[model samples]
Target: MTNRADLHTLTGAYATDSLDDAERAQFEEHIGQCPACAQEVRELSATAARLGLAAAVVPRPALKEQVLRSIATVRQEAPRTEPGPPGGTVPRAPLRRASRWALAACLAAATAFGATAVWQHREAGDARDQAREVQQRTEELASLLAAPDARTRTAKLAGGARATVVVSEGRDRAAFLATGMAEPPRGKVYQLWFNDKGTMRSAGLMDPERTTSALVMKGRVGEATGMGVTVEPAGGSPEPTTKPVALLDFPA
Candidate 1:
């Protein structure tokens, strides 16, 4: 039941595969008939793929040739024959056949090594992308906090936990921070909402397993008057299904 506007805001997350299964399904259904959202998702997905590729290390053109050459040049040692009864030796497999087997084994090993190298490089690239994303979010959060019009409000929640919201209308963004938050009951999560007049809009969600920290909400602040948090089934509800644990009003 996510509003159409909030559903549209999920294109980026869907492109990055960041949405939980439920949210992903919801977005998928939304995009089936919405050409605009479908197009945006496609573009964002392509951009994300390009970013991943940008971080990948390209191997030298000659590297494959060198590996093949090395495999081709490998000398196969003769198999040792076991001693047999009465001054005779057990017959060994044909040298040609043994050599072919050895070559095949070498080729297989080389192929496996190549695959491992590629996998490692991709993993390194993913790590770099994650680091860059973290840095970018950190910078954004810092700017939001330092905005001249920034105002912060804190409210106590259940179990003595507290929520602190830093909002900067001038920047059209807000950040949510929490401390002493205990994990929600099994199968439930904390969902954030933007109070637009009396109509609440889905802000985003807090994963039950992750540490609740500074979160820059998913979309523009617009003229939202306040923010609130409610417990919802895992993956969140389109609207708040429970009483808000905490609510904070923006500074006038």
Candidate 2:
């Protein structure tokens, strides 16, 4: 019996109809209750259909004629001479037609399988890219904390949760790390801003559900003298919609 993980991997093959009878039965049973698997199968099937349509092309007149002429020159296999029960020897024309049908079926299966593999590869690549981006951000935060000119300041939010910002003028970057953050009001998220003297520029929005987060700010430190956090509507606004819950001033 295949485990759920193994069964999940069969989605691509199942979409392509490349699975054998037993495996297909197992997968069909699995998909009946697995919404994720069913959704993936639907998407892959649609992709395969588009790929088939895109790959379609009419054969050139000369190529068609050449293939027909070449077929006459090809030698056909001899039919069996052994005596059969009642019908005797099977006719050669039907055997030839059967072989052609088999070849066409094999080609179709190959095409579908190829489409599945390509779709899977693209999904894996996107996952890898997201992972790479996360790793890069983590590294930047680490470097900012280690900078010789780095200065840190901490401020308490409305609910006693502490938010810390590390600003490094030499690195021209700042990082914000906080834990124990309380969830904002419904349909709201926490937004960060860089205070350039009296001017406040948007930094980025924090994931409201996360109690702990570490991130490098969006823009350069430049002339920004302070930072603040505020609760804003989901997706955030161009300007702060509420007073800051926390504020930190960069060390001189």
Candidate 3:
């Protein structure tokens, strides 16, 4: 149904009893022509005669000459080219052209369909890979949330003008999502940090597009009592460069 015209020859082949009714009728409609159907019928005649011969009795040896002479006469006779039953011309030339074109088109279409199917299969495989990576990252985040000695907190990281904080809590183990008035300079990244009383530990990295309510880092951490974000160098900084962009008072 995706391509109605494509089923014509297959239907023609089918209508001659080579295929069943559904496919035969479908292809006939697909061809949208009468000459194609007639050609298919004619081509099928020899095959039908072969089927009939299995049950036929052998002719007497004396009749062989008579049968041969009749065949020769039939071959020499001119084929009738009168109009068909519907008063339509029994188109011989058009039928040949249409069938050849239809066959060529079918072959070309089959090749294109095969290629498209392969490409889509590859794309689906790549998507599955990406999905697997995301699932792994979520598992890592889950482990961090379930740490037996885990400490939780939220902080509004205060930067130059405005700030945002990491909201890591509960089974979700979310991270820095919102932001206040601050911008990372060129080629710099916003790094997530968890301050345990005195030492600042890296939670992960954040990007402008990574800002979301359920934000989480692909890595895991432990004993994080407070959350902070800061403008760090390209990858990340060993320590916080500026004040906290946002801070959250996590539960002990």
Per-model TM-score, in order, reads: 0.49, 0.49, 0.36
lDDT per residue (tens digit) for residues 1-252 in model 2: 776656766666787788899999999999998786686666555434422321222334565576689789989898664554475544433433333333333333332232222333367788577546655554555455545567777667667676777788889998776756788889999999999997889999886766566677888989999998889999988988898888889877
What's the CA RMSD of model 3 in angstroms?
Answer: 29.6
Whole-model lDDT, model 3: 0.48
- Residues 40-67 of candidate 3: C-alpha lDDT, one tens digit per residue: 5444333232222112223346555755
Best by TM-score: 2
TM-score of model number 2? 0.49
Specify the poorest-scoring 10-residue window by lDDT in model 3. Answer: 47-56
lDDT of each: 0.64, 0.67, 0.48
The candidate, 1 or 2, that scores higher on TM-score is: 2
Residue 134 of model 3, lDDT score: 47
Could you list the CA RMSD of all candidates, in the order they appear? 24.5, 23.1, 29.6
